[model samples]
Target: MKIVNKLKYIGLAMLTLFVSACEEGFDDINTDPNSPVEVPASTLLTNGIFNVGYTYWDRDLNFEFGELMVQHMAQNEYTEEQRYSFATSDFNFRWGNLYSGQNVAAPTGGLYDLSVARALVEENENLSDAQRANQLAVIDIYMSFGFQTITDLWGDVPYSQAFQPGEYPFPAYDAQADIYTGMISTVTNAVNSIDTSVDGFTSGDILFSGDMAAWEAFGNALLIRMGMRVGNSAAVAAGFGGTLPTSDIMLTFDANQDVANPFYQDKVISSRDDFRISAELVAAMNAQSDPRLAMYAMPAPGSTEIVGMPYGLGDGAAFTLKNSTSDIHTNIEDDPTAPAYLFSMAELEFFRAEAIVSGYITGNDATAFAAAIDHSVAQWGASSPGYGASIAYGSSNAEKLNAIALQKWIALYTNGVEAFAEWRRLDHPALTPSANMAPGVTGIPVRMLYPNTEDGTNGDNLAAVGTVDLGTPVGWDN
Candidate 1:
């Protein structure tokens, strides 16, 4: 997969124009009828896709928040988030970007851009019915992915009325159950709506290059993912009934400063080593002799051993352990053009295995389970001979599901948000709460708290949603 360099140019140009148009004298300067003030759907698509990919790789949200919470990575310096102590302000970026957007003069958010694109697609006069339908479906599919991330993070969130500023300024937060149902329906409909005969977006499509077939596969995979997440095996079966794409849905980055992989820039370019592999994860992999460990981390400096830092340690202790602990592998942190995955074929296989065990799909659970591991190892280009034979798929459904969940956790490396969500849903390979926890923090957080700004801006709606706390589980988690 290659990063579209044109996306960077288009995004920057649109932002400049957007900011200039907000000035008082700008509108008067542009009197030409042919000059369009409104940003086109293609430009919006580029902005939205880039933001979504960027957010997933963001240090604050995905690393410090999701990865730390799930014990995949640990803090080596300030340990507030690692110890489950964080201000509501920590979530403002993610929450705001998903619902609204940043930059008052030139806002660009995933949901916001996709919504604008949908409207523009509907209004386009040159597009044929099939082209328009496929385009709209593609937008909806991306929107569904964004919504799923939002609802999974918090128990309830603004969904039904979101993005309709004039209609519902303070959109009521929809319950997680209702949101999941809606998302599943949206993905299903989007998959059905796609017309393979025509292209979705001939330009500005960063994921699949306007391939409707890829879009359809992505939608089905998303549907299955959501269904399996909420314990709806029937939806999983429905999704598995269709053809799955051979490739993962991802966004690739380039070495350019404007579009470099965030993790790479943070660790290598900036020379910041604020995080280390967690001892918990290291111990888990060591127990199974997981071959991916070599691919996931580097040996501690001056030693051949790959040591992990103790999770949730105090600032002094964490700093002390930092040098002895391994950082992320050079292949990852040292490479600026790595790909960030939205959904992977490995994850799809895991879902299929789960659906099979649930008796909702016709397939051998063990075969799918083995294939899942093989896909994961192949995807990472790791050597793991006799790996599948080493692990056992137990007889009972509980044991089988446990095996799947544990392996899925390992396979979901670097994708902290999705990994955290699955850990909450499965509760397998039970993780211990940090012994050096923050004040008033007794257990691991099940969900993220709403951003503090929401209270000031949408206080009434915020209050109506009930208590917002780290301890409260999301709908599917319970």
Candidate 2:
């Protein structure tokens, strides 16, 4: 009876082994097709491009900080920033957006995505010579733009060893000057890498849709802008160590739901009453009889005057607006489908004018200035009856500079961050400091404080940069 029981157990064990072997085959047959092993380069590019301009610049820098610092707009209720009271910061998020910040589902990571996108094309064994060159060139442009935005805002940031995930858990900060120099080289290589004979990343591209000409123009324009930013127009004149762009770099949006103007989305469609034009902006525009005024603000209550609210005036402050203070105009407030209006022919012309003034280029300042005014004025789709007569460029160096700066200020309405940077660079329009300054704060901030993320993880590295305060200028603020 014992021998019979042992034989029966052995037979059962053999049947169990057969079932386990068959289950291994079932896994291979049932592998999920819907799951993706790797993201495509095109999707990465789309996310990176939109997030940089729309997510980081348009929202965080422009909406939260830029508008007030430049004295363009202010808030009534949540006016802590306007009052010069900065808390920790959006810098970590800024870094993430550009390098590895968590973006919305599907499309995310700024420079990180671009870097991976470039690698994707470079590593692909099937792509032809032209395909590789064009794709890499576009990626280079994206990288340069991302880098400039970083150095310009933060002064010193992780770059040399950044973005190397496990390798650089705590990347060292590179000086802004060094970062700018490297960016010049990167942009140059990008321009050279573009193979006009081959196709580009057309389907994946949102800005210009793979047009190499637009890409080239964008890269070169960025180079010029960065060069000028460092007060080195001569370097920009020679193309930041290479060739300058002759063509224009411009970005205009239509009524596309996916890629509409952020301002329209926030203020008009959502109907949020968080922000309004600042007093300084209204006074300055009205002083110049600027044609772009009406397009920016509505007339004050019971008066034709388009007055704006004072900066730093928080809740219960001496102000008069019935829940709304000079809301943005119909063109912007009404059209959720409005444009981001990235750059203008006027802006390029202004750069040229400033380059000449700084002795970087040999063009006539007056001519360049006049041309800049014409382009900028026309960009607003407004008419000034006596532009050449009343608002013409001045004669003296200081006067002409002020004129250039003032006009540039007017031209840079929605583009608040760039406007703020220029204000620090040139001191144009000479904005009056708000009386509602935060306690212990001296004046309006020239550069935002370093993000607190560095304080916890990169504490030692952050210390090397020195103490961050409101009055301390950024590295390039020289």
Candidate 3:
């Protein structure tokens, strides 16, 4: 698979500019030399990409909420989240960072930075028409990705009215259905606007270094993913019509502490052992004699046995069995340079197979299903000749869809955010709530609750969303 190295030059360039600017303003007494009048688009682009990657891959939101809910990873210390004990405050990080946080133009994280970068690029007269369009299109694709993540978790969220603080201070929450539709429009427009002949971002393009063709492919793939998400036949067709990205869109990292892989930093650098491979995932893999299990989890300490920890248990029981259970494989958990994917070819192939099963597109489900597993296994640095044969594509469409969903679930091991949404849609593997769950947690939660911050700041809009709870289904789940 082709991957962009995410060169560290962006940081160097920013530092060089800062150092150069300091000398110019040093003689002036009135000027505040510390702050720049305007930030460059390249700087904003780099920061926006990093923020998106960091926030999505965050341990609290990704591992604790999404992974545990989908039964991929089990909590070892804080079992409350694993047991469906959720607090509205827990979601504040994702909500605040993704929308309007402290700064309107340059928030600490989320789509605000991307939007700002797009505006800067547009305003820059130095750039040619092709360069400006390509850059803006790439930014649009990224913003759509971020917004989709937001709407997927929460049913109704601030979208259309968001990012305009001066005009609409308290942005109204947009319906999940409308958000999906808006994303489709954004992604479609972005894809159409891409001019592959020209460069998008000549610098600070961490994902694909000025590769407009790659950006176009990424946009198209994103559209397909979104289409499958909302069960929109027209969207599926439109996306399939264009070129689908063959390689994975990844978030790469370096040795820099600020940009290093969060999972590695938390698990190895901090020496925290708060998570383990879940028994549910382990049993499923074990049943199929999955070769990737060796790569997914490490053997129990001292013994070459992969023992998965129980999903959600009391603190005492969990601690007692921690040593006996398997930690995640070092290649994944401890590797500082491991890339987090925005989208993978494996997932795309799975979507293709699913689209066929659902009559969204015309293709052979069996062939696409086999390709999906092959891509997944190969991507994880594993090989199993004839592995596709082990998982049968049944005669009926329903059976084929179930098989695709189950394999796709395994393929999406660490990508808990995407996995959570897929699980809600497919409902395969038949997951149940943990036995030691919080009171009133009768079943698995289909959607995340809004942050308490929303009630405090946007009280009117919050109340207008109507009564909701963890079990309430998002629009796509129907």
> Candidate 3 clashing pairs?
none
Residue 177 CA displacement from its true place in model 2, Å: 0.6
Question: What's the ranking of the predictions by TM-score, best on top?
Answer: 1, 3, 2
- For candidate 3, write residues 85-145 as lDDT tens digits: 8888877655765553221212143455565566577778999998888888888787777
How accurate locally is residue 148 in candidate 1, as Cα lDDT from 0 to 100? Answer: 78
TM-score of 3: 0.90
Cα RMSDs, all models: 5.9, 13.4, 7.3
Candidate 2 lDDT by residue in tens digits, 99-215: 553433213445655655665777778788888878877877776776666666778776665544344555567777777776776676777777766788857787778888777
State TM-scores per candidate.
Answer: 0.91, 0.85, 0.90
lDDT of each: 0.76, 0.65, 0.76
How good is model 1 by TM-score? 0.91
Q: Which stretches in model 1 have alpha-carbon errors above 4 Å?
A: 1-37, 101-108
What digit string (tens of lDDT, one per residue) describes model 1 on residues 1-478?
A: 3333333333323221110010111111122233332767887787677766676666756787788888989889988888888778888766765554452212245456656666677779999999988887887778778777778887787776665545465667778888887777777777887889887889888788998999888888987999988988767877888757797777888777556787887877778888888988999889888888999899999998789988878899999888889998888788888888899888988888888888878888888888888888878889877576577789999999999999998888888889999998889769888888878777999888888888887888889998757888888887
lDDT, model 2, position 32: 19
Q: What root-mean-square deviation over C-alphas does model 1 reach?
A: 5.9
